[model samples]
Target: MNDQMKVRFFKEARSEENFVEEMCNFRCQVRSDLEERSRLMSEIARRAPDEAGARYLDTLIDRQKRDEHKLVLLKELLFLARVETHERKLDKLDDN
Candidate 1:
């Protein structure tokens, strides 16, 4: 390919990698935030003045756990996609 095309492709690849890395970082932060929230909620539930308040906190914690699970799945999918992208790029290089 032409020099300009190669440069453009390189830029695009770099941008995509950056985007994926950013997403991974953001997800990690969100997961950490959720963990902290759950921990705080658990502490509050333990010292809760009423049963109802504890139950409510339990529900919130469950929701956060579910959200965290979904986020983990998405992170795994993103990691696989990145690996596949690299594999394809390597294949192309081999072809050339």
Candidate 2:
């Protein structure tokens, strides 16, 4: 979301194929993040079970779940972006 990143995305979006590739890369990144977060959460849960610790864990898990939900939503958006690329390709082929 910085200006430079925004410009890079704009350039990528200019090419349907490149845009799809970029979206795939982004999706992979989000998936990796979710996996790492899950691992850390598991470790935290295992190490902490005192009354105070449980409260902290509950709060952390709630925030983590929200983040996970956003990542899943992002994956869906990426899928939709790729679908547009496929549709455009099909339209070109049909014209040919």
Candidate 3:
């Protein structure tokens, strides 16, 4: 939730065809984050349950897994949208 590693939705292009590029960058960042979270979750899960008792760690791990799933879906959708955007531009040129 902090300024660090926040995802931004570009409602409009940043003046050119860079919006797709921006989305790609966002997807990459999200992918990296997902990998790191999974790794950390794995490391934590390796510990004995008694050590991480009270269910706090379990709750956090579950939340991270859910977040990782969401990011995977989001990145796929972004890629699809970018492809469609490119195809539209090509179609416009064909129509002209």
lDDT of 2 at 55: 82
Q: Which regions of candidate 3 deviate over 4 angstroms?
A: 1-16, 51-54
TM-score: model 3 vs. ground truth: 0.59
Ranking by TM-score: 1, 2, 3
List, residue by residue over 33-81, the lDDT tens digit for candidate 3: 7678677666666764565542656776777776677666667656766
Q: Report the lDDT tens digits of candidate 2 across residue range 12-93.
A: 8788777778867776775777688677768877887678777877876786776677666656756777788889889999
Which candidate comes out best when scored by lDDT?
Answer: 2
lDDT of every predicted structure (CA atoms): 0.69, 0.72, 0.64
- lDDT by residue for model 1 (1-96), tens: 235433543554556667567657656876887888888787777788598877888788787877677676657756765886798779999999
Candidate 2: lDDT of 89?
85
Better of 1 and 3 by lDDT: 1
- Give the runs in model 1 whose Cα sits over 4 Å from its true position: 1-15
Error of 2 at 31 (Å): 1.9
Query: What is residue 25's positional error in candidate 2, in angstroms?
Result: 1.9
Prediction 2 global C-alpha lDDT: 0.72
CA shift of 15, model 2, Å: 2.3
